[model samples]
Each structure stands twice: as C-alpha cells, then as structure tokens.
Target chain A: MKPHTLSVLVENRPGVLSRVTGLFSRRGFNIESLAVGTCEEPGMSRITIVVIGDDAKVEQVMTQLHKLIDVIKVSDLSENERVERELALIKVNAEPGTSRAEILQIASIFRALIVDVGSKSVILEVTGDTEKIDALEKLLRQYGVKELVRTGKIGILRGSKSVPGSK
Target chain B: MKPGAKILVESLPREGTEIIFGYPGGVVLPIYDELYDSSLRHILVRHEQAAAHAADGYARASGRVGVCLATSGPGACNLVTGIATAYMDSAPIVAITGQVPTNLLGNDAFQESDITGITMPITKHNYLVKSAADISRVVQEAFYIAGTGRKGPVLIDIPKDVSTGLAEDTPLPEKVTLRGYNPTYKGHKRQIDKAVELIVHAERPLIYAGGGVIASNASAELVSLATLVGIPVTTTLMGIGCIPCDHPLNLGMLGMHGTEYANFAVMESDLLIAIGARFDDRVTGKIDTFAPHAKIVHIDIDPAEIGKNKRIDVPIVGDVKAVLQDMLSGLKKNNAYEPWLKKIKHWKQHHPLRVKDDGRLHPQYIVRALSELVKGEAVIVSEVGQNQMWTAQHFCFHHPRTWITSGGLGTMGYGFPAAMGAHFARPDVPVFDIAGDGSIQMNIQEMSTVAANKIPVKVAILNNMYLGMVRQWQELFFDRRYSFTELPPVDFVKIANAYGIDGMRVDSPDDVVPALKASLDCNGPVVMDFRIEREENVFPMVPAGAAINEMIGGHPRS
Candidate 1:
C-alpha cells in the first residue's frame, strides 16, 4: 500500500483524538504515522496523518473522517505540492578518540545538532524530510546507535495555498 | 439565574418534548427534583434498558426525538443495548445520563462511569458536560444532532454537581449551528439526471425502499414515483409500510425470511433503485450475486452508507424525500414494463408464502387474524426472531410508522416497552406487541409500568416453548441437536394476572380471531398467549451467505 498524507482540522475538544483514532482502528484503516498539534486558529487542532491504502480505500477514509462530528476539514496532501518534514533525535555511543571524531563529522555533514554530549554517548538531533532522516540514521548505525525518537511527518501546502479551515 | 437542573428541565419543553421515558437514581435526584415541578410528563420504567427502548419506540412512532434518562455507571451501561438498537435503526433519541460529581469523575467514584467514552462508537455524537453553563447549549445541540442528518441517538452526561450549580438564565438558542455536521438535503443535480436516464430506459426496474423512507416521511413520494414509473416495489423490514402490502405493485419484504416472489423479482430485475436503505447483509445475501443483472441506484442521507456494502451505479446522497421529489419532477409516466410485470405476477401467483397446516395453531394465522381484526391500522411492534418475521410476513401494513421492530440490532426485549411508548405517542391508535415466549420474558417486568399507566396495549405471545428462530436454525443447519434452544414452559397468562392486567390463553385455531378481538376491546393492557406449533419454521428462508434465489422452503412448485 502507498502512504498518503492527510491533513485534518478538528475542533479542539476532549476525547477528539480518541474519536479519530478509534474510528481508524474499528474501520480497519491502517495508519503509518500521525502528529497532532494546535493550528493557527484558536480552539482548533490540526492532525497530520500518513495512511497506507489504495486510492479507493483512501477515498473511503476521507469520507469516514468527514462523518465524525468533531472533524472540520480533511485534505489529502499527497497529490498536492507540499513541504513536509520529520524531526528525530538519535543517541549514539561515542568512543574517546577516532570514533568520537567520526561521529562529530557525520553529524556536521548531516547538519544535525549535538544536543547532549555524555561520557559514553551523544544525542544527535536531526530535522529533515522523512527520507533524509532515514539516510542519516542509516549511516549512524555503524557508530552503535543507543536510542531514537521521531515526531511523525507533518506537512503544509507549498506557495500561496494553505490548508482549508486554517486562517 | 437558574440552577443547571432547572435549566435542563426547562430545555425539554423548549425543544418541543412533551414526555420522556426514564428511571431515576441517586445522581439524578437534583434533575428529578426539578422535574417534579415541570409540566413534562415522565414515565418511570422498571429498568434502564426498558427506558431507552421505550424512548426509541416513541421516536420511531411519532417521528420526533425520544428522550431517556438514567444514573451513571450501571444505569448508563444498561442503556447500551437499547442505544445500539436505536443507532442501528437510525431512530432519533437523546439520552440524558447523570454522572458522578466532577471532582470524583475519574477516581472511580462509587457510581461513576465513562459513559461518553462507552457510547462514542454507537452514538451519532455525545457530550460530557463540564460546566453548568454548557447544559442549555448541550441540550439544544444534542436534540439538533440527534434529529438531523442520519438521525440516531445522542447522549449528554451531566455530572451531579453541574446539575446543582447555578448558571445565567439565558433563553434557549433559536438555532443550532454545528460546523462539522451539515447534512446534504438535496441530491446532486447531475446524479439525479443520470438516475432518471437509467430509470427511463430500464425494462425491469424494482424499487427497494428501507427505513430511510419512513424516517424522511417520503412514503408518498416513493409511492408516486413507483406508480408514475410503473415499477414494482419490494421492501426491507424497515420499509414494510412504505407501500401498502395489498398494493398492486408491492412485492412484499425481501431478504432472509422474505417472500419467494420478492427474491425472484430481485434476481431478474434490470434496475434496482435502493431508496434510503443500506444494503444490509441480511437484505443482500451473497452480495456478489445480489441483483446480479441490475444496475443499482442507491439514495441515502448518509454518505458513508452509499458505497458501504454494495457498489452503486448512480449514487444520490441526499434526504430521501427531497431526492425522490427531484427524481419525480424529471420523470415522465411510462407503462412499457408490462412484460416485466407479467413475469413478476407469474412468480407471485406460483410461489406465495405458505405454512403447513397440521390442524394445530400457527403463528402466521394468528398474525393474519390480528391484521384483519385491526383492519391494517394498528401500531404493530414486534420482538425479534420468529415473532418479528411472522408479523412482518403476514400482517398487512397500509401506512408508514405502523410497523416497528428491532431490525438492525435485533434486541430480543425491544417490543413490549416499545409498544408502551407507541401507545403514549398515539393513544387513539390500537398498539400491539407481537412477541415470542423467549423474547417476551426479557422485559416482562415492564408490565407493571403499563398496568400502572393503564395503557391499553394488546400483547400477542406466540408461545412455542422454545426460541423458535434458533430452533429452526438448529434444525436446518445443526443436524437437529437442539441444545439450549428449548425453553421451560411458563404460564404467561398467570404472570399477566399477577401484574393486575387481563390475561387469556387460546389453544385452538378457531379462537385466534376472537381472542384478538377480545384483547382489542379491552379497556386496559391485555396479554393473549397463543400456544402455537412448537416446531413451526418460518419458510422461504435464504441460508446466510447464500444468494437470494437459493430458497429452502415455501416454494409452491417445489
């Protein structure tokens, strides 16, 4: 199944997240990644979700999302020209000498920040599109990665277009 | 200024509610106290489940939003089945549940429950009121949401403290505006034109109407469209009364336990116009082969239901009445379907719905007798299973809203309380609850509520000493290993008398009509127990997952 990004705006209310996620689970729709936060408008939240399905299945997902009372708008951004990014923090083991130097150089090449430097490990904070983050993580795997955390993909329309219901 | 409880009590009348079916508990005392002085009449049901079913019954019968109330935790939980029943059937209802004090909400307070979370899946929408000030707006919104779009139950959970707290005495809002919930009322013009094009050229078009027709009050439009186009009509259980059973073009109920002729018509039709009915599994057995030769035109208010089960050639998403009216305006009178009509007539004449006569009482005879006695004008409600199928198959319904049953959820204990609710909605009309022995015992406690109110609801129990439907299935599919389908005999007449209501038992076939007449003539609630054939099976059955044309019995030629 291809991953399709959907940007949804909903009324900021208690249990709204559960309602959306609950619908996905019950309807057996697969969700690849999801991120939720307040949008530009007050009393509204934007949920960016990466869903895996074919065209017909994705159409059904959009239609079902529209049925939820709290959801304000749903737009599929996969086909539109958009700017997308995901942030990931990777903590890796760093030896004292040459290995430490190599890790620092790799971080610099990827433009990742050395957020925390400990005696045995360093936490590298990376922000980029999903593929870029994946590439950096792949190279750092040789350095003995300790841990990794990611904020799932978030997107916005490029140029003058803004997601509807967000003023 | 006004207390939340008073505002809540006052809001009902403002929303045009004259009565509510409810059971009170500790958490709801403040609201009940306010209700004591209010003009709204409250019927105290014996159980919370009965309260919800009765409210649902009221909504279906009157075409209004029925209301029910219960305490938190167990009380709210008990209303789950009834709420799901209404949800599945798309009946409009507002359930008011009392929650524990806001401070104790999540601490597992003695009677606290996360009711809003529990009902989120079944309800159209729900609210857990956090402030006393939100009560008025929540009530107004709940009613509006429940009664609009694809109507279903909406619940409001008010904490006990919120009920006692004071808020500004604002007047009720004149209009409700929900940004995410505007329903499409008019069908897309292009789609309507396409549907008309298909209807115009179709040689064998069949109209498959369902609950949406009754919900939208579109029976007249449906009849007019069918008559003008000269298309034969068949109905789902919920669509039984949309076209009079005796109408020249009516083909009776379709699906499992449906008529043989109706199934035959569906198999041969070239165009299937589905109005306001979802393609439920029971209605569309073996979906791949259902109406195999027909191009489907599905019209429904809920967009989610349009392509949910069956693919549609012309999808018209709008209110049924509005869409039918649009189609009616674009159509011309056509009587070119004489060949198709003749074929259907042959099927109807050859394979009529029939039951064996062993010189013993049959449930079908009792239902037919009741229909004749009432002259097809009674408000007939039914419990689920064999009794429900028998009533739907045999009884002649000439008008909408006259036949109410638990079609979607198939809750067994639905009818008795629902019949009481129907009685309250239209006291002038004769109301009957045709029930099975096993199903009637589920909510038989409601007898006290009916007897106390002196409602003249007539109950006909087709006692077979078994869960007849399950037994039939076991006999057909399980090699006759009855298991627990057999139920111990209970004297229902004695139980009715214990509750201080008139009771009678009829064992002879000749006494069916006279017994029904006596029940109808009674001034108060009466229960008539008919000892029917214990092994009687409902015929013209379509085995689950089989095509509609694959029948087990009731084929005259076979």
Candidate 2:
C-alpha cells in the first residue's frame, strides 16, 4: 500500500465537509491526515486528504468523492510530484537549567522560529515535512516539551501544475 | 403585485407545474389560500407522507419535478421518509414546508421545526429561506436542481412571515446558475469508442440496465443498442421498463427474487455492459463473486457512480441516452453469443416461475390477470413486500414510466398516494395501486383524498392478512417464529365505502380478472380486495449476502 494524497476542490458551504468525511468513513477508508482551507477563488475550499490504500481503494475513494454534489473536483496528488508541508507549534520548558541554550541551538539547526519566550518556557514554530517535524519533536522532547499543536498536512503540485477538478 | 404566497402560487404554473399534493396547517394557511384561487391545483392529503409520495409518483410517471407542500413541525417530519424514498430511488420531487416565523424559528414556536436541517441528509439539496424576497429565485433553483442530472428530492422551508410578507415584484429567472452543481450530459467520445470496441470483440456480452435509463429516457436507445449488437439485456428492479418484458432479448429482472435465468446470464457473461445501473448489493449478492468473468463497462451521467460500488474496466461518465446513442451510432451488426443465448434459454425453460395451483387464490395470478386486462395500458404502482415483488415478476411492462413504485426505499403505503399523484399527472390514463393487506393499511387514509378529488385510480389489494415478506423470512430463517407478522383481518371494502369509494371483496382465483375488470370499468375510485393464499412465498430467494447462484426456495432445477 502507498500513501495517496487527494486534492479535493469543493464549494465552501455548510455541511460539505461532513459529506466528504462521511463518505470516507462509510467506505471504511481511514484518512491519515486532512487539511482544508480557502482556495484561490472565493466560495471554493480545497481539501487535501492523506489515506493509506492500494490502487483499488484509492480509486473507489476518489469516485465516491466525485459523487458528492458539493464536491466540485477531485485529483490524486500522489500521481504527480508535489510539495507538502505540516506546521507545528511546540512549547518547550526552557527552565533555568542546562538544556535551555541547547534547545535554542537545536531549533536554529532545524531553521525553527522562536515565536514566544518566557522565563520557564519557549514556544518554537516549525514548518517542514512530517518526518522533519517528527525529528525536531523527538529532539525537543528531551527538553521537556510542554504542549504541541500541529496542522496535519497541506500539499500542492510542484511547478506550473494546478489542482484540476470541477471547473 | 402580490405577496410572496401569491408569487409562489403563480410561479408554479410558469414552471409547468399543474398539480400539488399537500396538507395545510397554521403557517402554510396563507399559501394554501393563495393556492385555492391560482391555476395550480392542490390535493389535500390525509397525511403529509402521502403528499410527498404522491409528488414522487407524479415525477416518476411524467418525467417532471413533482411538488408537495406541508406545514411546520410534525408535518415536515412526516415528509422525511417519503423524501428519503424519492432520494434513494432518484425520483425528482420538490418539497415545501412552512415554518412558524422568522423570529419564532430559534425559539421553537408553535409548530416550528428545523425541517431543512432534518432533511439535509435525505435530500439532494435543501434551503431555509429567511426572506420573502428570495422565494421566487429559490423556487426556480429548487425546480432546476431537482429535475436535473441524477434527479432527487429538494426541500425548501419557508417561515410564515416570508410567505405573508410583501416583496418587490421580481420576475422569475429563466435560468439558474449554481457554482457547484453541473452535470455532464454528453458521453466522452473516446470512452464510447472504447466501449464499442469491447462489445465488438467480446464473445458473450450482456447489458445490465438500471433506473438511469428510465430517468434519461434512454429506453429506445437501449433497445436499439441491444437489437443492433444482438446482446441480451437484463433489467434491475428500477430498470423494468427499459425494454418490454416480452422483448425477445429482454431477460426480465435480475437480483434476489429476480428471474433465475437473468441471474445466471449475469454470472456467465464475458463482458457486462452496465448502463446507468449502480450495481446494488441485491443485484451483486456477494460483491467479489458477482460477474467475476465479465469485464465491466459502466456508463452514467453522474461521475460519482462510475466505480463506487464495483470495479469498472471501462467507465463512461455521461447521460445514458447520449452515451447509448453514440454506442449505437456506427455499431456493426453481429450474430455472436449464440451459445450464451442458448444457455440462458435453457435455464428459462427449465426453471420457469410458477406457483402450485390449488383451490386457493395465488397473489401472482392476480398480478398476471391485471397485466392482461390492462394490456400494458395502465400505470401501475405497488406497495413494498410480496405484492411489489409479485408485480415486478408478473407485470408485462411494455413502455417506459408506466410502472411507478418505491424501489430503493421500499416504503410501504407508498403505492396508493403515488397512484393518486400519477393519475393527476396523466388524467386520461388509468392508474392502479396493487397493495398487500398490511402495506395498504399503513396509508389507507389516502383513499379519502382519491374519492374527494374524484381521481378514478383503482386499488387492488392482494389481501394476505400478514406482513407477508416478514413472515416469509421468519418462516424460512427464524424457525417459523411468526412473531407479530400476522394481522387480524380488516375489511378493506368497508373502508373504501366509508371513504365514499365503491369496492368489492373477491375470494376465488377465478374471480380475480372479473374483479379487476369491474374496478377498471367503474366510473370512480374502486378497491378490489382479492384474498390470496396466506402462506405463499416469493421464489428464487437468494439468502442475504450469498452469491447470485445461491438459492433456497425456488424452482427445483439446477
């Protein structure tokens, strides 16, 4: 099985998300990650969903997505080379102790930004692929991370390619 | 020049709406008052559910969007099942419900309910109009959406204030533009060419047609394709009218309770041309084993259905009529699949559908008699369960849209009201609702509406005095634990009389035809209650979730 990212363009209407997610769950397809936001056009929203399935399952999910009336278009981004990102905000306990300077140093190495600083804690915002983010989180856990919030994932076709769905 | 109620009433006729089925209450009284004087005729139903079913019936019979109106709260809730019925069956219907008032909506005032919210999952789309100004535009869009590609029900909930408030007169738009809702109507040529190529090369090709054919009015094209290519055709329950039942190439219906030969043909075919059919579970049985040998070609107007249920080797997303027309256009004549036809005919001959004849009346004989007497001229509606299956089995439908019944939802009590609505749509045609004793009583109150409206639709009750299907299941699978399936006999003739309609009760098999003929000859609404064998079961029963070849009680042939 391979990870398939589906880029779905839908009308930004109430309950459209529920309709899409409902189809996924009904067909017993577990979505690994999902991200939804405003698209280039007003009244249209783009949803990027990650699912682990073979060709047969991925094809079925795509076809079912197209069945939804609110869904304008759907494309499987896995077929094309694409750029993907996930953003995480991690609040780590700097404490007055030995690892505070080391935490900032590790953040510098990963190109992470220090969004907030306090005497006891420093919040670092990291943007990267899932693996990079996971690696940074693993390093920061040694410094006693207080809390973490992450957006699942968002993707786009690289260079001159656009999401082609309902036009 | 008029309030929103008047505008709503007038706009219906402009959209070619001739009749509406509804029940009035406090909030919708003003609209009903406007309806009384306007050219739009309204039939007052005993229940809101019947109103929706009647509208669904009208739509299925006439190929137009049917309209139904109901008041707020429970009235709107009652319409839900019927709305869902139409949605599942892909019938085009528009349901209108009145709310208490704009202010009273959140407060839950008298007779107010969130009908739009309640019906969202069941309908194709829904709206809760907050202003009278939007009524005309909303109604226009509602009709357009309801009747378009992959047609289904749409609901519009209006607050009382909106219906009564004055709005600046706005002309109805001749067109509607929804940013999201566009249906593909023409088949892509490349896919059609691929389909034709597959058909040309296949040794044993079969056509599996479904409700989409009827919705697209593509039956003629289906016939041309099958006749031209010499391919055998089998219809799903929804596709019964796609070809005449007696057409030489037509293999009756396919599924559980379907003809044995049809199921065998589907299993044995090499290339299955699925036109507008969704490949429902009942048709497929066990999904993995269904048509295992066939390379499937699925053509539908809605792209969503292409590979949702079954894998399609060739998927063509477009309107059925358009796609079939292209497939038939340069098709070379061929006389292949002779061996396939021979095998199908052998099965048909050996395992023919029949019931043992005793002194008792069989339900099937009544259906057969009705088919013969009507001579394929009348519109037939059926209640769910054995009566529905029997009608599906025995009725020789020779034309499209002549058979209107609940197929997907299988809602009982749907038949009579639907027949009433069908009669209103085609005033000159005879309409009959074949029902079981249990199913008919669910909405028997609609008989009063029929009598009051002077709709001369006939009701033929195959009175078995049980919820026959449930009892059959209990008998076969549950060790004959009858539970509450049996019902104390009620006199349908008396009920019809109380509603001011003439009726009769026939006991013997010999009297079935004469009774049907008498009901047809009657000048007004009539109910012919024919008492059928109490314990009879529908044959060719494939246990649920079993393969198509699996059968329990059926013809005793391999």
Highest DockQ among the candidates is held by which one?
Answer: 1
Badly placed stretches (over 4 Å) of model 2 are A1-3, A28-34, A51-55, A92-103, A118-120, A136-147, B100-112, B171-173
Clashing pairs in 1: none
TM-score of each: 0.98, 0.93
lDDT of 1 by residue, A35-143 (tens): 9999898999999999888877787878888888999998999989999999999999997774888999999999999999999999999999999999999999998
Q: Give the range of the ten consecutive residues with the poorest summed lDDT in model 1 chain B.
A: B549-558
DockQ score of the complex predicted as candidate 2: 0.39
Give the Cα lDDT of each candidate: 0.93, 0.89
Candidate 1: true contacts recovered, fraction: 0.50
Give the least accurate 10-residue stretch of model 1 chain A, judged by summed lDDT.
Answer: A158-167
TM-score of chain A of each: 0.95, 0.96
Model 2, A1-167: lDDT tens per residue? 99988889998877788778877886788989999999997888999899988888788778767756678888988899999999999999998676789998999999999999999999999999999999999999988989999997899999998886554
- Given candidate 1, what's the lDDT at residue B76? 96
After aligning candidate 2 to the native by TM-score, how far in Å is the CA of B430 from where it should be? 1.9
* Native contacts recovered, each model: 0.50, 0.40
